[model samples]
Target chain A: MPQGQPEVVPDDGLTTRQRRNRPLLAVHTGSMKGKSTAAFGMALRAWNQGWSIGVFQFVKSAKWRVGEEAAFRALGESGAGGPVEWHKMGEGWSWSRKRGTEEDHAANAREGWAEIARRLAAERHDFYVLDEFTYPLHWGWLDVSEVVRTLRERPGRQHVVITGRYAPEELLDAADLVAELTKVKHPMDAGQKGQRGIEW
Target chain B: MPQGQPEVVPDDGLTTRQRRNRPLLAVHTGSMKGKSTAAFGMALRAWNQGWSIGVFQFVKSAKWRVGEEAAFRALGESGAGGPVEWHKMGEGWSWSRKRGTEEDHAANAREGWAEIARRLAAERHDFYVLDEFTYPLHWGWLDVSEVVRTLRERPGRQHVVITGRYAPEELLDAADLVAELTKVKHPMDAGQKGQRGIEW
Candidate 1:
């Protein structure tokens, strides 16, 4: 559990309820697994609460069959809870002329950030999960300062969760909740590969 | 983002299929939230894969309403997939007469370990989630070496995930996957309380 609290409270003197309702900006980083998985779990909770959810994935190929994506999509289509929009920014690699080039990835990243920024301004989703988003910021493909400013100024009750290793300092400083997943140990150190269902 | 691979592969030369069929022992620990939450998220995935699930909460109160518990229980009871067994070790606080002191928690912890051991021996569930289990080992209430040995020698394809802040060295060494969640930032320091849906 996080033992440290923000040292100072806002001058507004918000009540517990108000603080609870306020959207949180969270960052899940560090070199370990479950960063995206944990954020997805929060999305599940948000969906259960009838909050609209949006998941934007980067780095990971769109073809990656993450079980959570299928499960959450089914739940959304079932009409049993809030709607969910899952966008995979790494869907296609066939850029032809610019195939496998850094510029291609950079352009796509910038485009993805632009979309997220627009949605944040519009408050399109109650909960926004920017899965592996820190990579773009770290690679300098997307402007970290711009992202910090946009996320800080996002409207409504939009809770944003960004996950990726080597998160920049600017994002961490602006985030209300940040959890860094450290690798205490892994089977791969013993020669095991990532397994299905578990790794996915 | 772990760069290290297991130093050597076993002489057994197991194929991908054989390896994929094997169970995993994962530990989620450290002074940050989402240890159990990530484990539960894995449970959600396991449920989707038609794997039976067992969740044992060692420290949290039974009366506590965790969103994952309710969600998983509902999924279990729905009969759409595998069943789930939810056990709360700290259900009642009134055992002070014969127990309830530090010793009481230790006794319960031992008993809980025994039950889990029995079930693991019996292969009761494909996925077992030992939530907040590290505290007992850290507290000397449960023997770390014993737990490590038990996990190492457990039979069948039953996967286990243990979560707590101060995980024991023995358990970490035995675990195939271990994640340590570090607290980078928190709202509590600002006097903000944990919120519904997000926290629970």
Candidate 2:
């Protein structure tokens, strides 16, 4: 795409603006990092446009203080852009010092997906980020077919972006935009561990 | 990487914390829309860490009110995180209602690179984003070897990220992390034009 111009224009009957303004179902997936980071970046753009934003973290614990979460929460309260709501499934529950059983985590993930489904049905948010959501679908904790169907039929101008590794093929087929963040190189390859602010 | 852990730990004669805290040179390239957006997301994390940020937009016009720029400017002013300074070369100059010759734009890019070099020498910023910088190297407007050398030898712990398509081989070779944002699918394929708040 040259300066955001499409390479091949389809013979759609819609006007340029109409087609351009359509809501997007974007998926950021790959083994490399930056999947959720890129999704949060899009959320920033949506918030800048005064679009209500909702973030659901599936893998991270609610106690985990991600820098993006803090920044966005401050931005939401500042009344400069749009409102933001952050929720965590705490399935992986890192740093919480308490681990749930696999079955318990599966149940928790299902509950989280149910909440997202309800919100989608109600058209609650202009932008929805299912952060690390692919885990549930990949692990068969959530039904891939039902998730795809619901997202495909989601109403209003809601833009939903899902980020995680191993995104289901069904979800990718339903998405309008899919970004695969491939790693050519990483400092981790040089024996570096994750650091605060940079990695979190 | 499982929970930010390196797949293999090397015996590099450094402690975990020292190895983890090293600054990074990241390059976001490939034909996709979210390169700059993802880089901005990293900037948010850096800001939350109280790191001074400097963004140099090599392609966008100076007058264009990019949503990220506005949100970041507000964040900088609010004193909620670190300070942010944004600069534009106005090379593309879209929406500026004025067209500069190719040579003029090339000169402006060189000037912008010079400014970044000066800042790096002075350690003026903790984080630096060279937005759409690959265009200059790809078009032969700037010396790729020199840019790579300058970045590689830059003093202090300042982290640098360059974003754009067609990143030069030398730059990728020098970078510690290179994320290729491959476009799996796009709405533009359906003849969608770029829309405000999303594209800009």
Candidate 3:
């Protein structure tokens, strides 16, 4: 509610209310933490609005089982808000429990992107979270220009958020909102390691 | 789960496992969004870990209930995870639905701080989110030194996170992890007004 006022108002012809309702292509990209966490937070808000949610994790291991996945799974099943579907395109596509080669990982990442592209075309979900998605683009596994083009031309009123570090300039240019998390200080700097509840 | 490795490891006598389990005092601040959102996301992790969670909002209006409140309340009641308690020390302490004078707001903020301090002393919650607490310290409504000292001396392995803009120097100095979210760009920058679900 304390969200700041717009510093610049564009002359886009649309009324304020109409402009405000437009779907956002948000990017959470930076070297620090909370990129995916913030995206998940936004998904929580979208869910509260009764928007169907889809989350695709690109980097984290499926065996790790992050907290957002479990809580969202429960929230979706609770029948109190919107439906949630979580997909783990984990490191090497860990769902198969097989370690893959470099080419195999690249192929899997491309397959994951293709699935997301199909979903966007079909307008299957109101809100989609491509959690840690930038890695594939950064690693040159996914074509950045093509990804940007698909997102820019996404059909219907679906909101999509992409998160991870080193987001390609093309993707950032296409995104309507981008939040960069910078690390001022980290416990790791003081020899403290990540804890169970705090980090994951 | 994709959290990066520590660039530097200290010889602090504590084993890696012991250091990894240390409690964190995290601060999320700067002139951007996702401060409170990221904090709530971390709370989601804490909940999944079955930690008792307490959220005290120092700035957001209680009347304009944020989506996190509803979702967390649901999670707390569902008996599937941790217990959660949410307190809104809204603008003018709006729980009373009275627009208070400047002095009244200051007193209410002080009262809120005292409550948190007491809870810290009692080890009331395993995870604590002091949402938007820096404004009071920045506005001189609360003592920064005392607040920092209390958090530094909090009992047990409680993890505390404070979120807002312009965090006080002493608090930042004492914090274990500090994340400054820089707004690369926002829909607001393009004149889009805040909407119901996405903004709140």
Candidate 4:
């Protein structure tokens, strides 16, 4: 070896080091069918793979809605055990109903969105699900461009999943995968009634 | 009985139905989260209660994303067996993605939304969940006010669930329930690995 030669590093350490790759996933469902259920299945698959997950449901408040916490706990209790943390939009639908001043509602929505964005940026969850994110854009409560930009700028190797009927084109374009559910024939067409464990 | 009294019918040949007191549920999860699983659970609960149901999804093209048919089958296979049908948005998301072509995207989105509105107005289903409804809004692909008005004008005892992050205040105001999930902790924070069954 030359006197001035630098010591060569062993390849073992380099090979053993883990590579991080975070993929953004957007699941767009067309209609009332089963988009949510499908998204859940995919998440379950991911969770089963030993990945820690972060769950977010937009446009949701704990007052009138059945909380995802119950559902998450139920999922865990049903033998789909794993450590899953949940983050929820807390203001509920007060803005949509015009229950409060526009300023108040706007403030709440902004606060909620900021929290979501912060979490998305700060955490390194293996998976992040933004549930019902499209409504803000649909109702003119949030800027779509900002959302797209934020999603594009998300840090870490976390995988993102979005589910809803009308996904914006920008989001779909940026998405690696998109799934749409269509309506063909339905029971209501034939006057059949919706039953429990089937239509809830 | 008085001679002028009308006969009291026990059941006007219509099946006794229970009103669905539950709020409509919509979920948006990016990419590969368990949205479908959650939808399936909700559907199953509603189905067991004897309510008519309808399902639809928006697809840009037949070849693009996973079709609603597969999702329905998967949900059903996962024990959500019920009378659920899937519909496609027909127009894909690509047309909306093209910049400077707002008219085309709007037209397609309107057409798709018209179909949804028609179904909602028909009041055939007690619960309606628009999976990716926010995409069109985010892309400037659809008119948010129009969609909200249509939903607000929907008749009967129908409960609607619109899931997606970034829902506007107008839509949120129109909703009876709103939920937002915030992320607190995650496994990826410490560099844990993601596997197939857990993070798919």
DockQ values, each candidate: 0.39, 0.55, 0.62, 0.08
- Structural RMSD, model 1: 4.9
Task: Determine the TM-score of chain B of model 3.
Answer: 0.91
Q: What is the C-alpha lDDT of each candidate?
A: 0.76, 0.82, 0.84, 0.52
Cα lDDT tens digits for candidate 4, A1-200: 00112134333333212422335455555765555555554555555544566776664444312323444434443344345666555534322343343445455566667766776788657777667766665666778789889888887666787877577777776675566654433334333344334343
After superposition on all CA atoms, what RMSD does each candidate show versus the true structure? 4.9, 4.2, 3.0, 18.1
Q: Which regions of candidate 1 are displaced past 4 Å?
A: A1-12, A63-65, A77-81, A92-104, B1-21, B63-65, B77-81, B90-108
The model with the greatest TM-score is: 3
Candidate 1: count the clashes: 11
lDDT of 1 at B110: 79
What count of clashes does model 2 give?
0
Worst 10 residues of 4 chain A by lDDT: A1-10
- Tell me the tens digit of each residue's lDDT in model 2 across B1-200: 22567878888788887787788999999888788889988888898988899988887565443778877887787788899888777743332333455448877787788878888999999999999999999999999999899999999799999999999899999999999888888777766777665666
Kindly provide the TM-score obtained by chain B of candidate 1 when compared with the true chain B: 0.86
Query: Which one is best on DockQ?
Result: 3
- Model 3: clashing residue pairs? none
Candidate 2, which CAPRI tier? Answer: medium
Which regions of candidate 2 are displaced past 4 Å?
A1-3, A62-65, A91-103, B1-3, B60-65, B91-103
Fnat of model 1, as a fraction: 0.48
Q: What are the clashing pairs of model 2?
A: none
Candidate 1 has an lDDT of: 0.76
Candidate 4 lDDT over residue span B48-150, tens digit each: 3444545554434433223223433333333423345455455343223533344354566666677778778777676565655666766667778888887
Instruction: State the lDDT at A162 in candidate 3.
Output: 96
